[model samples]
Each structure stands twice: as structure tokens, then as C-alpha cells.
Target: MKTCLPFFLTISLLIPAPASSAFYQWTDAKGVVHMTDDAHKVPKQYKGKATRIEVKEPARLPEAAPPEPGPAADLAAPAAGRGEASVPGGHDETWWRAQFGELRSELKTLQAARSQKEQKLVELRRRRAIFQRSRDRAAINEAEAQASADDARIGDLLNRIAALDLAASKAGVPAEWRQ
Candidate 1:
């Protein structure tokens, strides 16, 4: 028994261990590709199309330098341009705050314009319905045309409002300022 122990140990050390997991790939009914470790998890219909996939481990990236200690460390570092200012656009905090205020104002103005246009559209639609009930073709046509124009205007205002809101958010405006 003692003589056989060393030989068994040597054989075990010489053999390579089997991989613990394998990847399988398949396409679903919606034509989306998927990968998983268990073949049984795949749908019955897709099993026939499933293919074994060999996954290679990704290479590790080099370690990054330690971050600088400051209140602005959590935020993204300023990009290169203009001066050595710390803010994103090479502007000071006061400048950014003023920009945020302007964006909020613009957003409010656009929203008000959109609201007015929407109200006009609703009124025009009501007038069109009344003309239809009275069988007045000319009146109905006029109201419909006005409504269509108002709809286009309202869509434009909404888009502008969305753009302003996005700008304000990117400027890091406070939520209370948005209101």
C-alpha cells in the first residue's frame, strides 16, 4: 500500500483537471442570441440550434493612478481647453450656476408655450367636432388645418423644452431650480 501511494500521487499530479463549466449559445424566437452555462436552460426548440462556445478569460488592465484628494474628486476631471479652470467647461462655479439658471428659465418658457399651444389645439379640435356635427365642410376643414398647425407648433415647443431640460441636467442644476 505504501509503495502504491507515491505512484498514484504522481499520476494525479500529471493529469489536467476538467473545466467546471461550459458555455452554450442559442437564438430565441425573437432572433436574439443568448449564452448560458446550462444547456437544459435553453428552450426545447432552440436546443437543436444551440452551439457550444468556448469563452476565454479577459486580460486585466493596468492599475490606475491614485485619485487626487478633493471635493471634486467624485466628479469627472476637467477636460483640456481654454484655461486651467477646474469646472467642466473651464468656467467657475458662479458661471455654471448662472448658466443653469438661464437653462431653467428657458425650460419654463418652452413649457408655457407648449401648454398654450396644447390648449389652442384642444379648442380647435372641439370646433372641428362641432362643424362636423352641423355638416359644415368649410368650417370643419378650417378648424382641422388650424389644429394641425398647432400640433406641429406644440411638438416643436416640447422638443425645445426637452432640450433645455437636458442642458440644465448636464449643467448640474439643482432639482429645486428646475421647478
Candidate 2:
């Protein structure tokens, strides 16, 4: 505990010091600028002689390029296939469309499942509130039990969504479905 006290004090000091103090800078005869804690330290001859130094900020630089994909990308690299390709059938670009269609179908199913779970949770909560208002022992007990079950179901759905999120990430799909 004693060892932690000093660490805590040091961290407390590191909390942003309010901008209360003013800074003063001046150049000497040799044209070398110097800064001091006290203005009086500046020699009388050089004092009030140098121009008031206005702070000129450095120019903003352009943003850096994102780092190139490394080992991970190499390991999970997609096949060297073109964006859209002609299937053996020589019909419309059916193969490429099929992949997107499959993803959309899965997404739709997940959304419906999530919506149903949410609606059930809402109904459970409403019934629980109604039971609580009734002030009957049996009603309260039943409502509380049902609420617990609903909570467990909600947790299960949340875990399922999490697993789906990992799958979507691996499949290079966006997070919209999970949300």
C-alpha cells in the first residue's frame, strides 16, 4: 500500500496541468534565442530590445499511407480470381451473383431471428411489469421465473450473434447484420 501511494501521487500530478503560466522568449546579440523562467534574468541591454516572438506553428503534413498487409494477408489470401467470371454454363454471371445471394439469405435469417428474440424479450418484460403491479404471490412468482428464462434466452441469442460476427468477419462481410 505504501509503494502504491507514491505512484498514485505521481499519476495525480500528471493529470493535465492547467494552462496558467505565460512563456517569454528573446534573442541575444549573437542571434541565438533563449528561454528563461524569469524575465528579469534577461540582461538589461537585451531586455525590451528583441522583437516580441510570435509563435509560428509548423505546417501541417499530409496523412501517411496505410501500412501494406503483411504475413496474415499472405496466409489468408483470396484465390487469384477476377471479380466476375463466366461459369461453364455461359449464362449470365450466375456464379458471382449466387455468392452474394447466399450471403444476403443468411443475413436475412439472422435478422429475423434477432427481431423475434427482441420481441419476445419485450413481451416478457411487459408481462413481468403487469404481474408486479397485481401484487399476487403466484403472479409474482410466475413472472419472476419467466423473466429469468427470458434473460437466459436473450443471453443465448447474444452469444449466437457474437459467433455469427466472427463468421462474418472471416467471410469478409460487413458488421451490419450483427448490429
Candidate 3:
């Protein structure tokens, strides 16, 4: 009973932080509809017209652990990959389209790089014995180090893509736009 008390308390504390309860939308003088998580941000004049929309965000399941690499590209990596910087203009249609285009292009580039790295890593590992006998152990070590860096970079690219997807989902962008 004592252990369960702390566990329940922790869960209760964490639940409200990520799950936004409501969204407030109001129009500015320019007729730009602005949506925000905080009601306080709504202008005094527009408060009466502001719509308080209660949103029930979908439960996010914990990410599954990445599996070991296999002989083929059929593993769970995205058909495309991704890269740096957070996309902006959450509610703007033009921005959303631009963000989607940029993200998809970057993803494609990263995916190509990922494929190249996978091949390079394989070849490096395969030539381990040859490198060992050539008295160029440093070269082999350098290749191994590069492989590690490539893994980290590829992982980051994948994460950036996932974040974009999450942002799009939250903004209620069309599913087809993500493709």
C-alpha cells in the first residue's frame, strides 16, 4: 500500500503536464484567427467572442525500443528519414505546406544517407581482418568511430521527423499532407 501511494501520486502529477485540456480561439483586429492553449492570451476585446474548445488529445503510447539491424532494409526505419530544426507557423496553411515540403525533402535525403551508411558500416566490418593485418589499426578504429557517429546522426534525423509528425497531428493537418 505504501509503495502504491507514491506511484499513484507520481502518475497524477505527470498526467496534466503534456495533455493540454483546452484550446482558445479568437480573432484579432486583422481577422486572423488565433488559437492558443492559454485563455489569458486572448485579447480583452475578443474574450467574449473567443471559443473555448475542449480537446481530448489521443493517448500516446510509449515508443518501442529500436530493434537490431538486419541484412535487409525492411526493418522499421521510415521509408523516408528527416533532419534539423523545428517547423513553425502551427495554424497557418501556407506555413504548414512549406513545412511539409521541407520535412519530406529532408527526410528523403536522410534516408539516402542512412542507406549509404549502412552499406559502409557493413563493408568496414567485413574488412576488419584485412585492416588488422595491414598495420593500419588506426584506420579501422577511425571507421568504427565514424560508424558510431553515423548511427547517432541517423537516429536524430528519425527523431526530428517524428516530432514533425507529432506537431502536424496536434495542429490537425490532413493525413495526406504528411505523405
Candidate 4:
């Protein structure tokens, strides 16, 4: 019995373990339900409804590429007759200036939009107050909806402005220019 036990143990150790896989379930727009093991197999229309039944193996990321030669290489090989200050990352001084100008213009436009949205919100609030005083529920509701929409627009504008500022900083724009 002892001899048989060791052999059985060795056989069990030699046998390959079962591979783990994932499954997903989803409902389609037409109210049809589907199940799949592969994420790629799930229908595009039903992607939002997909629920994973099993944990999927984490995808392996590709190895990072080696760094390219820097400003030294650019210095070694003079650009033919291009009278521009070229940076290491292929962005010349002119490009940076242009990008800064564009970003500033966009920032100005978004600021103007935010100002308009704020004004609209103020008007909506005034109207809402008037409607409330006059006991008009429908008008008040409409004003409230408009105010909410304006608020959302203002929020979006603010977020965009913040992102633009971050980008400007990363682009090496002068602090004064970014402001």
C-alpha cells in the first residue's frame, strides 16, 4: 500500500493542471442574451451589458522601445538651411511657439464660453426665482433644467482649461504665456 501510494503521488504530480479561462454574459439591444469566453467574441452592441463570470488573465504589455538619440545627434548633423531652433523631440522653436499660440487661443475661447455659461446660469436662476414667486411650477422646472445644463457646460469648460494648462506646461511654454 505504501509503494502504491508513492506511485500514485508521482503520477498526480506529472499530470498537467487544468487551464483557467474567463466567461462573459451579455444582453443584446434586441433583448437576446449571450455568453462567451473570449471578450472579442462579445457583440459590439452588447459590450456595455457584458458581465464577467470568471476573472480573465491580465494581458501582457509590450516591452518599451529603446530611447532615441537626443540633442547631441541633432547638434552633430546640422539641418540644411532650416533657420529654426530644433529641440531633441523634433519640435522646433517655431512649432512650440505655434502650439503655445493655439493653446492660448483655445484657452481664451473656453474662458469666454465659461463666462457665457455663467451668465446663462445667473439668468436661469433669476427666472427660476421669479417663477417660484409667481407659483409657476413648469417654468421653474424648465429654468432649473437650463441652469443644470449650464452648470455642466461650465464644469466641462473648466476641466478643459485645466487640461490645456497642464499641456502648456508640458510643452515648455513660459509660465506667463500659459497664464
Off by over 4 Å in 3: 1-90, 134-136
Where is the poorest 10-residue window by lDDT in model 2?
50-59
TM-score of each: 0.31, 0.27, 0.41, 0.33
Question: What would the per-residue lDDT of candidate 4 be over residues 48-78, giving only the tens digit for each residue?
Answer: 4564443323333223321223333443333
Cα misplacement distance, residue 125 of candidate 1 (Å) = 0.5
- Backbone clashes in model 2, listed as residue pairs: none
Give the poorly placed runs of model 2, Cα more than 4 Å off.
1-135, 176-179
lDDT of 3 by residue, 8-39 (tens): 99999888564435667666889787988898
Candidate with the larger lDDT of 2 and 4: 4
lDDT for each residue of candidate 2 in 55-137, tens digit (9 for 90 to 100): 22222332332112223333333333434352222212232234334444554554445445545555666776776555454
Candidate 4 regions exceeding 4 Å error are 1-86, 133-179
The global Cα lDDT (0 to 1) of model 2 is 0.45
Preferred candidate (TM-score higher): 2 or 3: 3
Ranking by TM-score: 3, 4, 1, 2
Provide C-alpha RMSD values for all models, in order.
22.8, 25.1, 23.2, 20.4
- Candidate with better TM-score, 3 vs 4: 3
Among residues 3 or more apart in sequence or in different chains, the pairs in candidate 4 whose N, CA or C atoms overlap within 3 Å are none
